[model samples]
Target: MTNSSGTITDKTGAPVTIADDPDNHRYTVTVDGVRAGHAAYADRTDDHGVAQRVFYHTEVDEAFGGRGLATILVKEALDDARAQGRKIVGVCPLVAAFLKKHPEYSEATSPVTKQILDWLKR
Candidate 1:
């Protein structure tokens, strides 16, 4: 979408939107109003005494695949969590992979417990 700053967006005229939906326990990613991807998580406590969320799944719609939407979606989700003084546990394989590629966030990630990991499978 074109804002006051005159930045252009996708064909639908809506700029990319990313936000944490705490009620649903997932971060939603949208492209011009259409849901493009999401990063799912479960909330818990981290070692640093900060709130932690275990990212257990991340996915992009098949139509949105090959466009790096998942990467963008996950990055926004992770970045937002970090910005809020929260830590993340990368149980989601995609997120784990993302962390490896971006070590700058590695230190902010905490380990996931087996119980939490098992819960994610359900």
Candidate 2:
């Protein structure tokens, strides 16, 4: 999960911070320095030179569940990939389901293949 904190948005004046922890291969979301959620992914470049971000798991702490943190985690993770011109791959069911619900991100998602899933497991 992320360690370097940065503010992303502020709707009610309380900022939400998202940070990257590449050593852990995940992005973490924190509120007021308290960890709230995270989205984990594996990164690599495809043979075609496309940056691929394969998200495998995303979760919010039980105490923070239903506070829309999971949505924020996914959005931050996906948007980060998009900003890097990377295509997202959904190996985790949660990510796949999220994409289905929010097709706005469909254009940036990479097609899932056996190879992608196999690589994520490693």
Candidate 3:
């Protein structure tokens, strides 16, 4: 079931919520009101000067492992990006793996480039 705040109860009955915290440059997921994980990203201008969101890391708290929170987090993050008209780039392993299995996002996804990696280093 879903709550008015947009939180949903998963199969385990854990109430989960995902929201973008742009100040932190990440989208965070909370389970039962506790932060479970976040997908970190950076906003960058691509070769064509189009703004894109580069997801470079994702992690869930060890206590929350195996809850599929990462998948939930990434999906919401990607959807939000698309809603905002930002192209997606998955540099993080989890995000890349998710993208591979979810082709519906292909048109909104951008290939990871050396320039993006280099920008991340700084």
* Model 3: pairs clashing at backbone N, Cα or C within 3 Å: none
Which sequence of candidate numbers ranks them by lDDT, best first?
A: 3, 2, 1
Error of 2 at 5 (Å): 18
lDDT computed for candidate 1? 0.79
Clashes of each: 1, 0, 0
Model 2 spans > 4 angstroms off? 1-14
Residue 110 error for model 2, in Å?
A: 0.8
My TM-score estimates for the predictions, one after another, are: 0.80, 0.83, 0.91
Model 2 RMSD vs true structure = 4.7
The TM-score obtained by model 2 is 0.83
Question: Which candidate, 1 or 2, has the higher lDDT?
Answer: 2
Q: Cα deviation of 94 in candidate 3 (Å)?
A: 0.2
User: Which pairs in model 2 have colliding backbones?
Assistant: none
| Candidate 1: residue pairs that collide | 1-15
Which sequence of candidate numbers ranks them by TM-score, best first? 3, 2, 1
User: lDDT per residue, candidate 3, 1-122, as tens digits?
Assistant: 45577767655778889999999999999988898889999998777877799999999999988777888899889999989899999999999999999999999999998878889999
Q: So what's the TM-score on candidate 1?
A: 0.80
